[model samples]
Target: MHQTETSDDQNSRQAAKPPLRIIISRGSDASSFTVRPLMAALAAGTCMLVIGGYLAAAGYMMLREDNSDTSRLTQAAQTRFYEERIAKLRARVDEVTSRSLVAEQRYEKQIAALKKRQGEINARHSRVADVLARAAESGLTIAASDPLPVAKPRPALAFDATLAESTEATGGAMVPIDASVDMLGLRGSMGGVAKKADRRTPASPEKATISSEPTGASAGLRADSVIMSRIDSALDVMNRQSETALDLIAVAAERRIARIERVTSSLGLNLNVDGDGVGGPFVPLTSVSFDARLARAEKAVAKLSSLRDGVKSLPFGSPLEGAHDYSSTYGPRLDPFLRSPAMHTGLDFRAPIGTPVHATAAGTVVSAGRKGGYGLMVEIDHGDGVSTRFGHLSRIVATVGDRVDIGEVVGLVGNTGRSTGAHLHYETRLPSGTVDPELFLNAGEKLSGIL
Candidate 1:
């Protein structure tokens, strides 16, 4: 019984073990199968993941490329915009530079003009200085009076430069300006300067102290400066007037000298050295009155010299010695030959025949010929309607249209037709009629007596 039971138990255990083993084996095969499919699926899934990852990466790359393209387009647009802006900026810079250069040139020009004006001012100042010095040298004083009856302040004048500068900006237009200098003050200063230059002093009985005025330096300096300027101006005027007078005199002298030269050339007279100098042998009769007038004019020259010691006097001394001399008289008396009362138009002097008869005064010889009663007669036409006739001459020394001097010989005394003796018949006629010959003779004697 124990053996049967153990055999049955063993058989049963063995049988159960087979079945269990089979079940286990079947489970293992199933598990294996399931595991195989799962593994394949996992492998495929891995491949899919890799492929998807790659595709995602490629999509991202494409998006990134699109973004990069967009960025490149935007950058290009910005670059182009910046380039255009830079070009515009460059053009603007060029314009600005050009304008700046032009402005610099204008500034330089203005500076040069200012410098030139300053130089002119300096020159004027120098001239004033010289004028003042001369005024001080003379013991003369200038007088000043009250201000002119004009307005206290003169009307203001706009600055020309300012108006021009405002309107010169690429346009032709008139511009109004408000900038103006104190014209009245400037005028006062100028007047003062003139007064000072003229050596004029304040005519006011009381002198104004420097502190009396607000602008001491300017006022005082201007006052003196005006005097100086006035002095200079007056001197200039006087000098010009004197120069004009001198010029006129010189012209007259030249004409007289030319006339004299012509007369001397025409006459067969010997002209050489004389007492004064070698300028001429005799003085022209026409120049005698001129010389007397010149003597008076010389007094004016002396006055000019006293004013300023710069002017020189003209040459006046002449070479002629004889200015007036009478050799005969005029009256009716007993003729030396006829012993009868006859009408004698002139007087006569005991002069040798062929002796020279000089001119008593400056005159022009109008006629030199034979008369009805007298021998050779010479008539002289003195200025101021006065005429003189010389008759009873042996030979006529001067011809018509001849100019003779005071000492020059015009004819020789002689006893010819209608003349009882050898003498010179001299007669003087006035504009109204014939005057007394003794009057002229006495006048000549007076001049001689004074000498």
Candidate 2:
């Protein structure tokens, strides 16, 4: 009974799923081939595996493409953020640049003003230097040192005492100053100071250009500050140099004028230039500027020059050449012809018969002819109400209306007229009357170097 049940179960199972079979036949050969169920199943399993693998590969590729797109979008957003940040920074930079430009402009203006002032100061100093050079050329020279003439000390005013103290601190004591000497070494010291100032001073505008550039705003500001400081120092130095040079010129001119006045006064000469040609209301100097002071100094020098010119034309030279012996002195003496005590109006210089008699000063011949007591006489009319006469001459070489200079031979000495010997009778006359010739000769001797 168990065997029949087993066989029946097997038969039923086979009927439910019969074996997969396929047959092929060749008619002529009568041969056949069949595919079994197991082979068919194996083939199906292999096909399913290939299809699943293909599907899995496709899905993975799609996921990878999506991730790539997300990455691209994220990169774009980050780039936009960076671009906005850059724009904001650029705006801030522009603002800072504008502020820096304003500051730089201010500094440039200051530099321009300083340069102008420096130029002006340099011009002033140059003018003062020119004046000093002119003064030296005109014989108004001041030595580095000279003998200071003793003088009564001037009573110092309150202001003068204070000034003296200040001056003493600089280099010298408060004593009388010498006109020809550069007292207190003020001139040399001021020149030294000026030289030092020039060395320390900044360059001119052409040499030193204003710049406000740097790696950053801070650096530019610092550079500007340094430039400003340098310019300030340059300005200070230029101003001081100009002032010192002006002062030196003024002081030197005034002192020279004072010396000239003293010499002329001592010689009893009133050669002061007359200002009657120009008339104006008297105005005292209270607020005199540098230019005014310089003008006054110039005027003083001009006065000195006028006095020198007058002195040169004075009758101060001898009428005879070289050394000469006086035959008779001027004033009351025995007359040459009468031999009686009489007033002699002129000096008699004893010389050889042909000795040359020269003109004492430059003048025009007024007369050259024989007179009652002064035969072969020559009279010269020097300007300024002065005249000279040469008497007892051998020959009158100078004609009337002839202009003669000092030391020019006007005649020869001889025993003519009322003279007892070969001699020249010389007389000097002023507007007042005939005066002694010795007065001018002595004055000339005293001022030999001055003229």
TM-score for candidate 2: 0.50
lDDT of 1 by residue, 83-195 (tens): 99999999999987887677668656755655665565455445433332332232111123433233223223221232221111110011122323332121111011111
Local accuracy by lDDT, each model: 0.46, 0.62
Could you tell me every candidate's TM-score relative to the true structure?
A: 0.29, 0.50
Tell me the spans in candidate 1 whose CA falls farther than 4 Å from its real position: 1-329, 335-340, 448-451
Alpha-carbon error at 432 in model 2, in Å? Answer: 2.0
Could you give candidate 2's per-residue lDDT for residues 1-451 as a string of tens digits? Answer: 9999999999899879855555566776554445577777788888888888888888888888898888888898888998999998999899888887888798888878888877877777777666656655445543334444343233322212222212211111012223332222222211221110000111111111111046776886888789789878877866655454445555555554455556556645566664434467765443556577567556655665676567657777778644443545455533334433355566666566777888888889999998767878999988888888888788888999998988899998766776555667888887887777666665554444445
Give the poorly placed runs of model 2, Cα more than 4 Å off: 1-270, 275-288, 321-327
